[model samples]
Target chain A: MKDQNGFDELARQKLAERDFTFDPSHWTAMEGLLARPGRKRGAWWPWLAAGVLLVGGATIWITAREHDPAASVTNPGGGPRAIAGEVKGVNGSAAITEMENASYGNDHPGTMNADPAVPVTGETRATAGTMRGETSGEPRMRTEATRTRKEHGTGTSDRGTVTMQVNKIPVSSISVRQGEDPHAANVRTGEATNDVSSTMTGPGAAAVAGDGASDERSNLATGAVDPVRSDASAAPAGGGTHGEEQPDSVLQHQPPSAGTGPVVVAGSGDSASTGATAAPAPVDPVAAALVPPAWLAITAPYELTLLGGAFSTTGRYTGVDAESWPARTERQWTTDFGLEAVRNFGRHFAVGTGVHFSSYKERLITDEVSRTEQQLSTSYFWVAHDTMVTIVVGDTAINGATYHMTQLVPMTINELGVDTDTAYQTMVIRQRRSALNTVSYVELPLLLDAHTARGRWVFGLRGGPSVGLLTGRSGSLPDNSGEGYHTLNEVAFRELTVGWTARAYVRYRLSAGWSVGVEPTMRGQLFNSLRNADLDRRASAMGMMLSLSYRIQPTPQP
Target chain B: MINDHIIAGCVRQEPKAQYELYRALYPMMMAICTRYERDRQEAAATMNQGFLKILDNIGTRRKEVPVEPWARRIMINTVIDAHRRNKERKAMEGADIDDHAEGTSGINDYLKDMEAEAFAELLHRVPAMSRTVFNLYAIDGFSHAEIAGMLGLSEGTTKWHVSHARTVLRNAIAAEAMARTEKTVSR
Candidate 1:
């Protein structure tokens, strides 16, 4: 106790002793570690924000592109709205200029519609006719499906009103404003039946008024007459007299191409002015198929992924028990490859199936030792007449006294107690023996996956059971000490194994269709790898898997 | 000065607060470094290396524990690393233990008579391995088993080094006292 106390006290005194004054210069050297160039701590949030913004912008661009085709079909002008107003001036040619000014703008001058009442003829007129099914050869059955909407104006009284018809069929009510130009008072109402007068106001009225041009085209084909000529002839008639007499005059003046149907022309210029009419042509069939189907409106939600990585068993053989020691188990890296197809039910949940090919290896190493020994046995010899003679050691015992000879005569005893021998030998040997076990398997996995996208990254979890069949198995026993180690086969481990696998992943979207991801998976076989063993030893594998996924969308319906 | 806030500032590697922390813990850490390093310059280098490690890994420190002990642990580990690097180079040098006979002087008497700097001079007389082992095992509150693992030596070897360090220091102190008394008598 005294020695221990003395030593402790002396050690404490020695350690407590030092010159501890501070030097200001030492600070420079220590601070150099923090100031090393290019060693700045990187902040990840800014990069993450930039990536999110980039991905968001790309998504918006892609969505806009998908809707671009349908947009062009409806709005041919590329402007906000289409205006189809027409006004006839002093001459028939001046009528186009007046109509352009009234519909578009005063400054908007155009010669595209020089003859405003010339039936937008040929292909456009024929297509419009076939759209409503009202051509010469076709039946009037398309009229029953057409629903006309009525438009009411500020004035309810029928003043200079003209009842217009197209393709010899009636649609719905059309009312003109009393103070407005009756020549350019052509207003078309769609199936919505909402009053168009509220929308028809100011310079923009022509813009909003053209919104229902589709319905007007259908109505134009319903009357079985020349639509533009009827509208033009109706432009000048102001009174009931012109309204009553215009149909007869227009019917007499119209050519055979304009059909023999009754036409009504009303305007404020004179009693009844008949306009020129163009003939309708045959409808085109190719244009009918260009209409897109309802099913092609949405994007597809299936994903295909290719997975490749390495996996290893998280198992070690500790020689059966803690005390029973022999060798160590070392496992090699195994290759894993898979192809997965997932069908997404929604944004968050999906079901998937995949085929996987994988292989694993393990080696058991043991230390070798050896042993050796020696032994001796007795023999009998006889001499006769100075000549040596040999005899069998057990012959005299079986014959009793038959081989006995006195004096110099040869005698041999089979039971003779004889010689002893000993040998000294030293041996030193140490060797290492190893056993290798390899297995390859094919598995089919059915899994339910769930995922969510945040900015450019997608986080997901997928897990399910797989039916694994052992395709190949090979094993080698320790060569020198072969008795200590035994070979193994697929039957030793079950040929068919049912195992569960689960993985969590983070994927970065590379493009709209392609994404790259890394997933860490944990898998374990339910059945034991070794049979007839007291302790259950199941092989479990855990590793990080890298994958590239491609999204496959459904083709646009014809 | 060595509170949670200064620890946090050091974790962020802010120079102003790191300077404050350095000035606060300078004396004690210098004492630790000086015991392990023979030269004052080498001790400064070791202490700075230890401080750099503390700042670099300060963010990982547990919040419940005081920062001083964690910093001290880094300092001790740094000193051990220095000892290991110099072990083979200094193995040939041996202590001259026959310079003084054993004397019955108490540790208290030596402390009362000598200043800390004077005691440090006597500690230099002990060999390097013995000195480091004593500092780590006795003063640093490290167990013989832990010191063995840290220095990669057997527990018995660490115990022997501690005993040998004590014997060398005691003899050196006794020899210094004898010389002083003789000089006073001659005067």
Candidate 2:
């Protein structure tokens, strides 16, 4: 219990001493941080996640369209353009059989042969499942069907036509064979809007004969042949031009809209030619060389700033051994303003300097002793009975009288031992006195600065030595004690003193080229304010500064 | 300014009132901060941050209760935060527990006239954990269980830390007293 009580008392006594003094600049710096706009540090992540999701969705959607063949053929408001036919020998003959509306199969958009020979103009054909196969240029017997739905008779259409080249050797051109006029069906879609030709460019019959000779020979003997074997590669090359056979679903051309720019379809060799020219546009070397980097284009090199703030003077006794003292410093409200210009070398670093006009007033409380002289006076009641005195009662002086007279003598004596009836009075005297010291320094500082910036935030550290050329000095003691206020002579303070100034600050950009910031600064004199004062006694200034800055745009490179 | 008025103003977040309260309470808070952080600059920073916290959470303080303990708790929390931030550095500087203990002086009279600053300086010599335990248990009137919960330690470990801190402080204080005595005798 004794230990606990001791600890409690110790803690209380120790913790209660509030004499701790901090560097005023540090407090100002903290104030600057507190006064800054609140940070939105935690808010950026959700937006970043949303952006990732959007990009991922777009990527997946693009990939799906590139591989889905049926999706390519089935245009909006138009049914699939299927071509149904049965091809046989000279005796059996081939014919267009059926047509029907159908959705694309929910599988890899590969080629398919329709259910055996339905009427082409009628709507009775079956929707066929997609058939997967390798590329084989061979004769095989099968019935195929197609359905075509024509909606908009005038605008754009998904009227796709398949042309099977059935020459004995490598067929270079696959012409569309019309139902009635096979010769006229070879027209390109660009020449006739009604004609839709999917050009499959490859060496055809030779590949089939080498790879499927047995199958071809058997079908040839049977005197019936499916002209187009359902090879996956036999699928229309929607717009592919780079050796690889592409699925037909990816659009070779964008649908036309009244107000839209001409659509540039990627991977379409013909569209690229038609869209611009078969030849590349001429490049201008000088213009290309003149382009500036994106970041530099938005940055300015020179910046100017204006700052204004309040400052307080902080001072401590130079080397007081004991923590108790008459040594202290008090401050008056001081204001400062500055103008600075900075030259930024790049995004990360800059150098600058500024001129500041400031005033500092502080009362230095010191003990001074002085003394004066005065005439001493004393008054006391001294009673005496003279050798030949008549005793007289009641405050009467008896000089030379008989005892029947009864006289009494009483007197007051001065410090010089003079007898008097009155109480003594002291003369006016001059005396020593100690008075509180008041001092002020008006300073004009020129300081160098350096700083860096990231995104919207900037941090800077600046400092340099400056001289305090004291423009004026004034002092007076508190009134009513000895005399009213008395102004001291100029010799009491130094004419000039050297000091260093430093500050660190953070700023945030409020808009283009304009920013607001707070700076915490420390300024101190190397020597004491008084001419022959103690070496440890000097004036220190700490302040919080608010500033506005504007970046000047650099002229564009010639 | 009256303490209650300062509390009311701080709760309202009036900057002038807040600054007034800061000036009023700064010394005691600085004492705690300096004790926790030997570096004067860091101690100042810690004290500023603690004041910020007090102002930020002033609404939670009950009316008519003493403000010192509440402010002290916040300052301690700030100290703990600072400690956690520099835990690795402290550990590197040998703040961790070790089995070896220094011999105690067993002299309690030395504490009778010890200056507050001197006592604090002596307390700084104790290992961080023991010093914290001693402060909480002996001075702040926290139970071992509370110290254990606060420091994430067991009750037994907390008890050991208090004992260790007392022994270290007693020895250091006693040694200081003996040195002063010898210096006086020589003089």
Candidate 3:
């Protein structure tokens, strides 16, 4: 037997080669997929899409109701109040909701900036399996509150409403006119608060917290003057519209706890009423409009993959020809099949799992090799999810199909007058061997996706290790006595095996509905003993793949 | 089908920018499995299978990532996954099993001097099982706890599997220790 290299040293070397260059391949199938328009469906991806649709849809619905008269009159939180008929006076139920909405729009102060990095693991590779520590709290990503203004410029010549500015735009009432830049109106209204020092930040907070706080904060925020004009039918009604007035009154209110902080509400005008005849003032603090956002709401995407795999050991591997170590090699093919499913928790993040099965065989590429072949031997992989990190941990076959070694010299082609360089004459020495094995394990991969084009294209770099346990293998290296062949190691191979892999791929989304991708990968064995007593000696194989995919959103439309 | 957004992993080696990288390329990676794999399920499994190597060694295989000929390496492997299948066939043929005392330390310890990249290369030398353990405990941040939970192994057994990594790596390192040490700088 010949000597081999140190397994640990090899592993280190293998890992250090993270600098592999990239190569782009044409993925016909995937490219075609990206080019051909299609719809997207998914497992968990659907849920993510659905979640966005629900919230986004609700937001849109609110926006559509912005110009409705009934909505405006019914709203108790916005600043515009309607003049109802009957006994209603100059001051109907003061809109408390409007007062609160007004305070929320211009009073509170906050800022947006970059947050700190949250480290999830340690620096060294040895202690890779150590438990992770907790990270610090982070700030909210963003906070925005819009204020709408309707200017009656020189449109029909019959309108006198020169300009009306309504602060604090609800999700439902953004705008219908195309290509109009709204002005940012900031009002200095935090002066009335003397005893409102609790958590509320506004002039009117003092009126509610300490003394008799009426429902007037919403009016201050909305800035909607009373004598309301009807424009519900003239709204940017999708596709077809003619009416310039709404049947329902519009209502707007600042949702409690809008962003990531505490939300405070007082006993202000939470109730607002809009009717035909009533003592209407220049400004009502009770009623306002609601409007939802549009396509800008689509901030993230859902991802899915249909995958297939084939693994063959028709290459140099552990102890397959143990007798000569590296010099004598035996080719083995382990046909394995796998299926995996993945779901993204958010835009560049996800988790998944899979199932694996394989069949093993030992074949001598040269006369110097002859070993056992395992069939339909079972094994499976458990993983956190799918990633490009290329960690392939899970169960594996060991001596389950060990290729014991028997030294044998090659048959020289020169004996037959054939030149060594001639394809007609090939010389090779092989070894005879046999073994058995079965293994199962799990893989965890953390991926790094470098994003560009506002998340349209991405090149991914992922790496994480995997863990596994060797369950069992052929109890003994079985002899081919029935075939009159001697067994090299009549005993099973090692119970446990370990190694690592490094790989990468690049992907591009051609449009909103399609994407194409490709990746060339290489896997090298870092350790051994899973096959022969072979040490340090490793094997490697490289491959390329091309694929395509599409994007799909939920029904509600985010 | 190359979209404008994806950059091959080979071009990106910085440790600080990995999370975003994995996300952008995962979908197309899933589609890649259809070729060599029997079906989408197997392809997906193989993609996850590649994780053992990817998570553990992508930082080192930077060369392979870029030089890949139109083939993006999305952590999905083919040959290594084949090892178990080969073994399975032999098992059906009645190969023997040997339960012996696993040797410890000696050359295995000396080989430790080699860098992490070297070890990652050597991992590709053996069956899939060995690589899985070495990566799980040595590179991918999986704890024996999580590893055991995922692989359905006793924590103790999972630990033993990790220890077994030394033997597999030793055999590979012992063979090309010199060439590895010299070329280590290239990574």
lDDT of 2 by residue, A1-558 (tens): 235435445544554543676456656755765576762122354456435544643454444333222233322211123322221211122323221222222111112122224323422222211111122331121211222311110101011122221111101111222221111111111100111112121212101110000001111100001112222122112221111221222222212110001111111111111110010111223322322222323268788889889888744444322122222345655777878777777443566666667666566553332334444555564454334434455453358643334554454333434443444454332122343343445454555554544445566666677776666545543222333333545335677777877776678776657889998776778876654333344666778899898888667689
lDDT for each of the candidates?
0.50, 0.45, 0.30
Ranking by lDDT: 1, 2, 3
Docking class of 2: incorrect
Query: Candidate 3: lDDT of B22?
Result: 39
lDDT of candidate 2 at residue B38, scale 0 to 100: 64
Residue A152 alpha-carbon offset, candidate 3, angstroms? 20
Candidate 2 chain A TM is: 0.36
Q: Which stretches of candidate 3 lie over 4 Å from their true place?
A: A1-305, A309-336, A357-491, A494-496, A499-526, A529-540, A545-558, B1-187
Could you give candidate 3's per-residue lDDT for residues A189-273 as a string of tens digits?
1111100111111111100101101122222121121211221111111110001121222111223212111112111122111
Q: DockQ winner among the candidates?
A: 1
Identify the CAPRI category of the predicted complex in candidate 1. Answer: incorrect
Most accurate candidate by lDDT: 1
lDDT of 1 by residue, A184-285 (tens): 223222121111111111110111111122222221222111122213232221211111122444334422211112212223322212221111111122
Best of the two (1, 2) by lDDT: 1
- Evaluate every candidate with DockQ and list the scores: 0.19, 0.11, 0.08
Please report, as a residue range, the 10-residue window in candidate 1 chain A with the lowest summed lDDT: A138-147
User: Which runs of model 1 end up more than 4 angstroms from their true locations?
Assistant: A1-3, A10-19, A42-558, B92-103, B106-108
Q: Which is the better candidate, 1 or 2, if ranked by TM-score? A: 1
Displacement of residue A345 (Cα, Å) in model 3 is 3.3
